[model samples]
Target: MSKLENIRIEGIFIKEEGRKATLKFDMPFYADSQPVKWADSGYNSISLEIDIFDIHYLEIKT
Candidate 1:
C-alpha cells in the first residue's frame, strides 16, 4: 500500500449553475497556485464551484 502523504490530487469536479454545470478534470492545481478546499487529508479528488470566466484559466499542478 502507498503512504497517505503519497496521495495527491488527481482530479477536480466543479458544479455551477447557468454554466457548464458539471466539470470533472484531472489536475494537481498549478505550480504557482495555492491549494483550495479538499475532500480529504489524503486528497486525490475535489469538488468545488467555479465561475465561467475562471474556467479557462484553470491549470494542473506539478
Candidate 2:
C-alpha cells in the first residue's frame, strides 16, 4: 500500500470549543513521481492519521 500524505493543522480549536474540528487536506502524492506532478497520475485513495482527540473527514477527487 502507498503511504498517505500528511497535513498539518495549526491548532485544534479556533474560537470553537469541542474535541473535533473540520480540516482541509491535499491529495496524497509523491514528489519524486514526475507523472503525478505533470501528467497527474496519482492514486485517489489515501490513509490518514489524526490526533488522539481529533476527527477527520477527507473528500477525494475522482
Least accurate stretch of 10 residues (summed lDDT) in model 2?
A: 8-17
Write one digit per residue (lDDT tens) for candidate 2, span 1-62. 96644643333332234455544444455345444554564555433334434434433353
Give me the candidate number with maximum TM-score: 2
What ranges in model 2 sit over 4 Å off?
1-3, 6-15, 29-62
Report the error of model 2 at residue 31, Å: 17
Give candidates' CA RMSD values in order: 11.4, 10.8
Clashes within 3 Å, all models in order: 3, 0
Reference-based lDDT, each prediction? 0.42, 0.43
> What's each prediction's TM-score?
0.19, 0.23
Superposed Cα deviation of residue 2, candidate 2 (Å): 7.9
Clashes of 2: 0
How many Å off is the CA of 29 in candidate 2?
A: 4.6
lDDT of 1 by residue, 1-62 (tens): 84323334434455453333343343344324335553334465433433343354455465
